[model samples]
Target: MHATTPPPSTWWSRNWKWCVPVLAALLLALFAAFVFGILMLVFGAMKSSEPYRHAMKQAQTDPAVTAALGAPIQAGWLVQGNFSSNGPDGEANLSIPLDGPKADGTLFVVAKKHAGEWRYETLAVNVDGGERIVLEDDAAMPLP
Candidate 1:
């Protein structure tokens, strides 16, 4: 005589036909959501930061970018051309709903790029739409 043993399942494998597809769908949805979230975050950062000239060029035509930044962008708006040295840079151009002010006055900015991110050695603000603030030292200045 011969004896045979039955396989055991932990409540999941036993429900293979149903569990598999459900798990696969859930996993697939999770992956899709994760990917979408990452994309939004990266794109949001890029959109919020207002990087460079090409982006500026795009901003001209993209109402969303324009509405996002509160103010019309112009060249020499970035830290390199605006500052005297390399360092952390931030443009509070877009708060949440809009970018910045458009009234006839200077745009004042007070910002800090979290430690280990970027250096803030030089800064400028076009107050009254004319002047741009700057630092007199090599070290980063407290946002003014």
Candidate 2:
């Protein structure tokens, strides 16, 4: 008696179980990368804005801030706030984290743009477990 040979298994029948999970994992990784990239872009834009830069500069240079938090102050990456602009008209309210050798703090800023200029309404740094240091800018100084 001759015996019949079984047909070879198809590719999908052989590999589908492992392939499905791998494909799913790849898609999830790609989606996560996309979200992280978008967040970085938004935060980078905020960091480059006039209000953020101005506040950081003040915090770094101010004598009161340096004395409280120590020298060589640095800004943190996760800044929280809203910044919107339309030509020379805009508003910015931001809270930027700061760190130094002695302590940590949060820099708060509230500013408005008018006639291509940034006018700060509130700019101060609250040191952790310490007093808040208010930054004062000269009216005569130019705003970039």
TM-score of each: 0.32, 0.92
lDDT of each: 0.41, 0.94
Choose the strongest candidate by lDDT.
Answer: 2
lDDT of 1 by residue, 28-48 (tens): 999999998986665555444
Candidate 1 overall lDDT versus native: 0.41
Worst 10 residues of 1 by lDDT: 76-85
Q: Against the correct fold, how does model 1 do in TM-score? A: 0.32
Please report how far candidate 1 places residue 130 from its true position, in Å. 35
